[model samples]
Target: MRELLITWGDGGGELAGRLVRELRAAVREGRLVAGERLPASRVLAAQLGVSRGVVVEAYEQLAAEGYLVGRQGSGTRVAAGVADGGARPPARVVETEPRYDLKPGTPDLGMFPRAAWAGAVRRALQGAENRDLGYRDPAGLPQLRRELAAYLGRVRAVVAEPERVMAINGVGQGLALLVQVLARRGRPRIAVEDPGSPGTLALLRAHGVRPIGVPVDEEGLRVGELAASGAQAVLVTPAHQYPTGVVLSARRRTELAAWARAGGLVVEDDYDAEFRYDREPLGAVQGLAPERTVYLGSLSKTLAPGLRLGWAVLPGRLAEDFRQAKQYADLGTGAIDQLAFAALLESGGYDRHLRTVRPRYRARRDALAEALRTHLPQARLQGVAAGLHLYADLPADTDEQAVADAAARRGVRVATVGPGRLAPGGPALALGCAGLPEQRLREAAALLGEAVREAGGTVREAGGAVRDVGGLGGAVS
Candidate 1:
């Protein structure tokens, strides 16, 4: 009862009144609990540097208001019901601890190379100079940009020079910065893949830029549709598309390059390019059209998302504008994290880690396919060649959301493929298999089967070698 938090407001009002208001607010805000004994008046008065009479007056007022009760020799206690304040309105959505989480694009966090990362960070600190500790080039730490340029060029065959590369917090920050740059340059409408990363579309719209949807097929973005979309700029995931897991085909790549050459700008999101299971992943589209494409890649998928590290390799002309935007974004990303990432890249530690983790994800992908085949034979799976998840098409009549909700109840979580600004096809499911143990993957698939049947829909396999279903509707402008 000796410790009480009381802030003495401006001496505009009586000290006792200010104390009473603050105490009531503390209880209402749950900072003070019911039935908890408060400090003696003299004790609180001394702590708050106020007079004992003021404390007594505050306590007396609060007691009259039923906010305090003085028990025999028990000192002053908060009233049992005073702390509740009032009943709160129901929340719009109540999040529960999920039994089985299958959210898309989520990596196996447990597999993060903590030892290597810590070692890299330690080395970075040991090597950092005093000047490196100060505010640096808004583009990024010079060492990191140089390392990134070389790493990207050797691995993805990108035409990146250190001078044109900018380190960002993550791909999201890079996108925001690029959007600002483009909007200033009179390009506000960007065509995105239909059913793309809805977060990307939302980011654009939130910043007053319009995102037009261009449908993507088995090969990837329909360049013809993009050209006709009347958008001056476009964003794409060429190595591996999101939700649907298709690579941009070579012919369409040529068309996209040509379109970019004809005064259009392309922003490439090279996320999850490290996890391709089939073969050496395709080179970045920026390599084919370096003059017009800006390539964005991040460590969120490979390393822990908490690192918040990524980079953008821009066309030389666009690099300066991006640097200015980056400067204004946060002054710059942290120097410690940047130098640490540079150490990781220069020491060949990053390559060694990729070698260790790639096979693990590949095995998980295989397990997902097997589980789906055994349990939900009626469902068609696509996008299994790479990335962390698969796109599943259930029987035509199934209610996607109902099935997902039912699966959630069965201790398995699944997500319905969002329609985004365009409906790619029938209601689709995006199921992530990474991080889940083999047994859980099988169990999740079984749960999906049960959920579908429970939704009053029959499970019949699609009648075809593969289900490259046609568009459910036209492109969304």
Candidate 2:
């Protein structure tokens, strides 16, 4: 048919053979539906600028393959069941677009340094050798590794060498590979913060690693509970805890390092460590216990998650195994992107970008905090010292899920802490401040306050008992 696409330049196959392939593809791909008649051989030949005999040959072959049926009077038509076999599932219905997306773990994507990054990309490509385009060391390009080692050391206080770093797709891949390595080493169980990342839990589960949930307090993951859990390894976001956004206290950091030093392993996810507001900068725990820590960092929050650029600084003992895992898992990350990021880091463009956006994100965070205080006066906010999202503990009587649903109905989307909790916890919401502007965040907070008020009464009347409300520290009202 005229609608069918055929590529004549797809190699040395005969025209009729190519026609057969195209027509077969069209039928299999649902382009030629069941009972749909194709043009006459002569007509199709004219339309395709081919000989009539070629068209006839293709038609004959397809007909014999049961893709078409022909009769003396009715001419050619698609076979009755052909299209059903090739039919695709209907597309998923997209959810309603929320007025404000307060979902955590996302940055203000519009602030990405497009020009600077583009320049870095251009320079990287121009400076790259022909061999650079081919498969590189699974650990990463030496240039990028060297740059990362220097950058991490100077910025995050991570004790890393180029040999100890392996470029990964993101923290997700790094974690997955580490899980696989641990499994091989007979350590398949890792302790995670109870109110930790649900995505992290799911990822660990997918990799066949059992995640033990340890409670998190204002000081961050409870080292006492983690030690009691008997998990040989632990995954933590020390710089800024997710959902809660609490930093690991100095005391807890010391205890954690001691635990790791005593035959334990720590996997530190240094996500969103770049944006610190209203607090003195705390270096990564890996800096304290590099020999027992696998420090993971990514550009997901700083630049864009779409870039999928990240690195893992592994302990010397695990470096070679992790490198092999990385080699087997997609043969290292994209070279061009790696080189581009390296150039950006070396040129200090990355630091400049962080400096530029830090103030803007801080402003948004301040606006959200102020709006929440003004609107939901009774709600206690926690972990606002650093990171893009703040944890808001709802009134004991409030229903967080109901509030989230009410906010969604009001065109504002927010995440509840239920999905992330391994044990029972009081109702709370994690509101992201980086995605929207200050004005929008204020508006969203107001709407959220209204939703909380509307949902509060219903939950109170239901007599739902609050559970596991002890560990989280005193509210910062």
Best-matching candidate per TM-score: 2
- Tens-digit lDDT string for candidate 2 (1-477): 346666666577799988888777777778888888888989889988889999998889888988888989888888877665667758899856678988877888999999999999999999999999998898899999999999999988999999998999998899888888887888656899888776787687888877799999989999999999998999888888887888899999999999999999999988888888776579999999999999998898889889998999999999999999999989989999999999999899999999999999999999999999999988999884778788899988777878887888898878777677888778888888888999999999999889988898556335454332112211100
Per-model clash counts, in order, read 0, 0
Local error of candidate 2 at residue 374 (angstroms): 0.6
List the candidates' TM-scores in order.
Answer: 0.79, 0.85
Write candidate 1's Cα lDDT for 190-257 as tens digits. Answer: 88898777567667788887778899888899999999989899989888887788899999999999
Give all candidates' CA lDDT scores: 0.82, 0.85
Clashing pairs in 1: none
Q: How far is candidate 2 from the true structure (C-alpha RMSD, Å)?
A: 6.0
- Overall local distance difference test of candidate 2: 0.85
TM-score for candidate 1: 0.79
Highest-lDDT candidate: 2
